[model samples]
Target: MKVDSVTEKAVKAVLDKFAESYARRDLKSAMSLIAPDDDVVIYGTGADEKRVGQEAIKTQFERDWAQIEDPGLEYNWISISAAGNVAWVAIDAVLKAKVDGQNLKFQSRITMVLEKRGDRWLIVQGHFSFPDQSQFFD
Candidate 1:
């Protein structure tokens, strides 16, 4: 299948929904966008934050979000590409939050892979990480 405007739009909508869900910390909506398979994987910024299933992902989100206060995301850039029934989105943004009574901000990059299942696109894999400053500083 060739990529088309409709497919691109639908896939982009999924990314928008994911961002909305994150803003609200809506687990149900977030889970809805994830593929219902044990193979689903999501990697967070933390070294130990690799979650390899829907349940584990949910747990990690809950744990991570609990400490954040007034969470917000500022998007500096985003790109979406789709081919056939698969889409991949790349995002660059700054995440701001008040964790432990201290303000925290970091620039992070996110990449999400989605697959069209029947009529809806669901995330199969995702990764969120901060840029490694070693190369620039060294």
Candidate 2:
């Protein structure tokens, strides 16, 4: 079935808020977008970096914030689709910041899965990674 307009809007709003919160370094608002359940998972860019549950995710975010200064994120949605209570979003984003007294820029691809609980949608899973340059030549 095609995704209804309302569901699409709700999902987009959640994603937008998440991006905005992250760019602003508002840890609380960023955490609010994620589900509180212990099953929620986040796979980050670093090797072997996987965070399970809210507390783990929060700690990871705190570490990230501590390492960067003036962080900014620009997201371009590749696609968003919803079926009933579940939705997934794919996006390409550029993250800019200062890390360890040096400028850092990462072009990343991100995928997020969200589930609707009542009227609110919360991220249940998120994966973030830089595109592998090897794939371009294959």
* Number of backbone-clashing residue pairs for each candidate, in the order shown: 0, 0
**What is candidate 2's TM-score against the reference?**
0.91
Per-residue lDDT of candidate 2, residues 1-138 (tens digit) = 467889888888987898788878899999999999999999988886799999999998888788789887788655788888999888999888898789888899999999999889999999999998777763
Evaluated with TM-score, which candidate comes out highest?
2
- Among all windows of 10 consecutive residues in model 2, the one with the lowest summed lDDT is 70-79
Give per-residue lDDT, candidate 1, residue 10. 88
Q: Which runs of model 2 end up more than 4 angstroms from their true locations?
A: none
* Cα distance off (Å), candidate 2, residue 69: 1.0
Q: Which stretches of candidate 1 lie over 4 Å from their true place?
A: 1-3
Q: Which candidate leads the pack in lDDT?
A: 2
State the lDDT at 106 in candidate 1. Answer: 91
Candidate 2's error at 15, in angstroms? 1.1
Could you tell me the lDDT of residue 124 within candidate 1?
98
